[model samples]
Target: MSLVKKFATVASGTLMSRVLGFTREMLMAAALGTGPVADAFYAAFQFPNTFRRLFAEGAFNTAFVPLFAKEIEAGGIDGARRFSEEVFGVLFSVLIALTIVMELAMPLLVRTIIAPGFAGDPQKYGLTVALATIMFPYLMCMSLAAMMAGMLNSLRRYFAAAIAPVFLNVILIAVLGHAWYKGADGLSVGYAMAWGVMAAGVVQLAIVWIAARHAGISIGFKRPRLTPNVKRLLWLALPAAITGGITQINTLIGTAIASTQASAVSSLALADRVYQLPLGVVGIAVAIVLLPELSRALKAGNLVEAASLQNRSVEFTLFLTLPAAAALLAISEPIVRLLYERGEFAASGATSTVSAILAIFGLGLPAFVLIKAFTPGYFAREDTKTPMVFAAISVAVNIATALMLFPRMGAPGIAVASAIAGWVNALMLLAVLVRRGHWGHDAPLMRRIPRLVLSSALMGGALYGGAIWLAPWLASSAPVLSQATALALLCGAGALLYFVLAFATGGTDIAMIRRNIRRGQAAAASMEE
Candidate 1:
């Protein structure tokens, strides 16, 4: 299949999950607001979720896919199967042991790493520990699922792996719905959601497991051993994990820093959700599909194809994300107010704060997506250490800047730190790629980028004026329907104008889009035969 088609499939699934995720956050805001319980719950959830992003999405997939593809080329299905089973046994056993240790060390984890700021409040600290304990087992489930997902992606079965994340949002939304029905208190909601997170993990794991079996690969338990393949995977995955989860690692640091201030963590979390829509849909989809494609091309000694794939992925990332960044900078207040300025959220006076943070996050949206596009260039070559080093540098930048700005700026400062760090990581990756002759300036992409920037700027300026014109309707005192309508119009008009500008300026054109479609169909036909 064509890269665009693969990205669309994954992005469609991600968009569904992100929409439902917004719903879950909406309900959560109403139920918990920015209270102590809310802070505790997000902290608790962030700990496990960070690992899920790090290990499942980041380390495992980056390290696993290329190697698995290599196995298939070298030894066929049977060899790949043997390799998978060997990795699974070791991964499963380590996860179980790790879960047990974490459960036992929950309090220390909560006090030290999870949220040191919570230590001042015994009730909050205890709640965080309890919630984290309940959710810690989720890491085990998702790690196993990641292994299966890597398998599916390498085998060209992208749909199941792409769709699995929806269940996390689905299960959380259902739990929130139940909580609302019962008019549950904050503490109850926290406990319920924590359990829901754990349940969702198991369901997600089962999904990929079933899909893997259906794909004609049934993996069973083998005695855990660090064979040559497993050892090699571990060696690669150790750094790849760090490199892959750069965003999450930075977020965890931000969370810890933001925890010192009241409501700061929750505020940052809300802003994160808004910006993540684009990141998940475009950035993640590109990374996932790009990795295997690049790996295959390079493995077959097709440097030209590898370079083309990298450039296209970068172009695709910016094409989608630039306007998104513009929209966020232009209409973040209305969007945040529309999504979360209801129930306890309105009363908590968090709309302005969250909106400010969202706008700052928008500043970094393109960088975040670019990181996803660039890193695959390294991972496909199995050079994980370079990105890992860059990731460390980015993390240091985030920590130093956040600490410096947060005292005066609060939540928005953390957003700034994350944005700066994202750019640092993305640029470093690109620089190293060019230095090593792995990437070069694609003439077409270079021409389109400035045009895309101009289009986004024009759209953003118009949307800014529109937001001012519609301020009355989007006001806090305005009717809910009026607020929703004004925000929708602002976004829709901005998108329409941006596309028109894009086509007119040759940032992208109908002919190019049509060619991509035809290319995708032709590729799919060849694969089928």
Candidate 2:
């Protein structure tokens, strides 16, 4: 029932999904490699997935959850339930129409938006259109699923919504594994995975819908109506749909720029998968849980509690984010090579490019997570326009940087641009929060942050040396097992070293962390009642 317990539940589910997703990407690398086929498939998938992230995770949730939470506070479950149903009906009808239209115009969508880079290659362009058409319906399914997720999160039930993403990875892994074992052709593999994407959507939607019903929130469809609350939600969601997702939108932009160069999109996609592991597990966990908690606190006029939770979320965010950033910055090459350098995946160009991209994104991991932790402060107050303005600035920065650097640095330059833009966005958000007096800069968080930075620096330095020491072994022509062992040892040693030094140097309190986890366990028991 407490914040810590809620975070644990969400974090666990997200972690599972991320692990599965990582495996899915690894398999995808072996099957498709960094080629036109891989490029086409990722572009096709990214089209629908972009909307999923933008609507489901970004704009819609920020708008929906706080309003839903307030309705519940105003008149309990009955009040929020009706509001949700109205919104759901409208959302469902709109998405259905949108899907039908988009499906009809798949060719244009592919040409203008998804992958203009493939236009010269008729085969690549045609396949991309086919794949995008097959997967476009996923947006409808996930948008509805996202609505359900927002409803569930407002009720403090996170497990189902958090775990629903795993179904997509599970389905993809199964399909890809089957295809690979059969040695299917590139188009056959892509065809199988594309259909799997749509199927996974249906499964994910069913999952959260069933969970919502089981939790006693009867959200069902009706004739679309523009009720006052639904209209308000639309008003809030419109700009959010555009501006709430600077990161995803920027990635899409970066990918679009990268697509102009053959196979560059796939390379960037692989790098994205690596950075997303930490982002999904830590950043998303904080944002998803923090938003509703902050909304509830402010709704009840508990400013002190709101401030405390915000501060703590930031503290906890940095505690994990700093080390994650370090890990990526330190071991990106070995990590990329270890996971993705096998089979058709060429270590020379693809893995090296991916490592560079990973390291670049790593430079901004802390800023990205900080944005996640801080933006909720605005969303909880229904002040999205400020974040939207800042998002626009960040997007501009990314575009300009990418344009300036892409010619010089290639695909990795887009990633570096994204990282630089992320820092700009974070600083802007924090400055605005402080200006509005919504931020809480407590001593514990302040003191721990510097220490966390120092400790992360220590880990980065150590990992750099270890990486050199193990480079020859990892790069050896020995058996896969030897490389695997060296990779594991390098990672294990780096993690162990970081934790020991961080704790010993008073960067993080082992006792406090243990107590928090224990409290989460105890509070979880009480939730069953």
Report backbone clashes per prediction.
Answer: 0, 0
Candidate 1 residue spans exceeding 4 A from truth: none
Question: On residues 289-377, what C-alpha lDDT tens digit does candidate 2 reach at each position?
Answer: 99987887787788987887888788888888898899899888888887888777864358778899999999999999999998899
Reference-based lDDT, residue 485, model 1: 89
Residues 417-525 of candidate 1 have per-residue lDDT tens digits of 9999999999999998999999977898899999999999999999999999999999989998999988888888889999999999999988887887787678568
What is the C-alpha local distance difference test score of candidate 2?
0.87
Q: Which pairs of residues collide in candidate 2?
A: none
- Cα lDDT of candidate 1 equals 0.91
Candidates in order, TM-scores: namely 0.99, 0.96
Worst 10 residues of 1 by lDDT: 519-528
RMSD of each: 1.0, 2.1
Candidate with maximal lDDT: 1
Candidate 2: residue 519 lDDT (0-100) = 59
